[model samples]
Target: MTLADPAQITPLAKAPAQAAPGAKQRDVRLDFFRGIAMFIILFAHTPGNFFTSWIPARWGFSDATEIFVFCSGMASAIAFGRAYDTAGWRLGTARVSFRVWQVYWAHIGLFFAVATLLAAIDMTGAYDKVYIGTLNLWKFFVDPGPQLVGLLTLTYVPNYFDILPMYMVVLAMMPLIMALSRVHLGLVAVFIVGVWVFAQRRLLAEFGLADLHLGLPAEPWSDRKWFFNPFGWQLIFFSGFAFMRGWLPKPPVTPMLIGLALALVLINVPLSNIGVREFGFDWARDWRIANTIWITKSDFGLLRYVHFLALAYLCWVAAGDKGVRLLATGTGLLARIWQQALAIILKVGQQSLAVFIVSMFTARVSGFVMDNIGRDTWTVVGVNLAGMCVLVLTAYCAGWYKSQPWRKKVAQ
Candidate 1:
């Protein structure tokens, strides 16, 4: 099914005005999904190493780069599309541009904040390994020799895990992305494949190339420098955008995607345990079922894309069902709070940059405090949970503040 242009998409415009008079009735599910994605991101990035043993080979959901990136893209499409409908591309572009700046500045602020905090830790002579991670910040500006040329190009630098830089690149290409999203989803698919292929060979390792490795790093500072590379990661982003654009109409709750995901896991598990020593193709070592279906939590793998797509379909079906909606509404205070908090969710989500920075700092603080006390599994989980709660609460409160008409008037 061919989707109409953003200017033509009318579901949002056609929404009943009683509950949300001016703005469209916000998609509660998007906010819920984003909240879930943020939790995954927090879990993946926090270094207490809770899931290290259980997940074994696969990095924990904390490394859920694909889910986060895909959600980001989908949110962008929905957001900008709504703006385009109400206003025009000029207005929409301006709004999005401001949002980009918001994210960029938030990233910059967090960098300095982390740097100062780390320097303090270093001066105090604490956590030497963590301190070592701090020293790599120079790579962001200087591009430390050959190990980081990918950082300069914003590609596949190994250690950087932030997605801000990658989002910036994607945002720069947004107009083109939106345009192509309309008439050429197939081309987008091909482009993603090409980038993924090039990434494996490190072809984009150069300064001007795709630079797929820039954000694959595990350290804190260098990880910030490379972040995630949009070049290789764009497939996941665009795939989400394509879904929102209605390019590939999602078939609801189908067995195909789920079955494919399972098959991938089944095939890759045995191969993974055998190790490269057993398999003649050393390349098979990285060939997990997740990779087959885009299960990559860290990078833009193939299995993750499939899994996320499948999940989206499932969510859509569930939410569209009357019984599901009734159940959600009946689920008591927490569910009701989340439902009424749609405005809050969108506000914090829009300010994702701030939320991320604050959350990271909260995590760091938790880590610092907890490290002084203990390093057990419960400690790690507690620290992470505390940070996550603080972040969410702060975001929700900020959103509530923003939603106040008095505050809006004052700002205006």
Candidate 2:
């Protein structure tokens, strides 16, 4: 069931300040969900070995990324709304701009660092054969050609794994979207849909046009990348942002949400089986529809979108009641540890981009080691799970450290 928007649920008079300058309690639901998302993402990307192979279905959690992205949009809306409500548009714009810059710089720095490290490894002959990182500047400049043309046009061109560039574009558009949101959400939805259509064909390809390639790669066998095309994915993001504004109907917590959850799950099994056989589990494939849709990650196809929406409804149902919280509070040390781990996961999620980039680097290194060093599945799982735990702990500890009085004073 859909809960009313915070704006509708709690009147303006009761709305808390947007991240007030104090030890403010966070929205437990959001944090908890983010924590859950991180875990799913981690498991999804975990080494494709025996440990991960036991997974009931490889695609069961396929919509994890979509849900995370939607939530990220909603989270941004909450932050921006609070900032606008309190400090006005100027402050809100500045804050978002800063955050966008922070993400951009982090990505750029990550690219260069990785590139340099890979170059070093290549020179040193660290492995049987060294692999170069794909973050080469030559891809974007100097030897720039047809591939770079996509980047130049900002239409469906990005390094398959790099989302920072598209994210920057989203940030740039946020102001216009926020303004439009105030006037009419229907207009915003139509505008997003129109962009999605334009992305399908080569025409309307212009500098700064919304790219259908959401930083995922196009494969020879499968052209779609990670399926986060701005042309198509923007609808998901915009829908979540609009939801925060109370533009969509809130599903009731009673029968509607419960029923939807069950129905979607049931529909997904057969749909997924048919999709796998017909579409080869590729999200971007054209299953042929009344209206054309780009199903690739770059095109944000119907399959992934529907999967995401269905999973989101399920997650909402799971989150609607306090059962999970009660479970967390169970009388068991293991439960307590899991709860604490969840807290750490939330901290990592808050600083998600940084954590994600680092995790990617770690995963790459681990992959190399696994391939070259040895095939110790149990050891790999043990080590990797431990590493994940350490990463979460480090994130939370760093956040805790940042919150210390001396550090706060020094920043001031």
Highest lDDT against the true fold, candidate:
2
Most accurate candidate by TM-score: 2
What clash count does candidate 1 reach? 32
lDDT of 1 by residue, 1-412 (tens): 0011112223473632221222243344545555555555555455564643333234221224555566666666666656654565578677667666766666556655766676678677656555536445544434545534443343433343356766776666566554454466666666657756554323343354645443334333433434355666777676666555555555645578556544644454445433444446456655654243334334455544554454455556667642246235547888878666654444445445456667666655665676677878677777776776777787766555656769778999
Give the alpha carbon lDDT tens digit for every residue of 186-237 in model 2: 7777777776666543323434443642344432223544334455566677
Task: Report clash pairs, candidate 2.
Answer: 1-252, 2-251, 156-211, 160-215, 160-216, 160-217, 227-297, 284-295, 284-296, 295-301
User: Residue 253 of model 2: what lDDT?
Assistant: 68
Candidate 1 regions with alpha-carbon error over 4 angstroms = 1-11, 14-25, 51-63, 86-91, 126-135, 138-161, 181-227, 255-299, 310-327, 331-351, 408-412
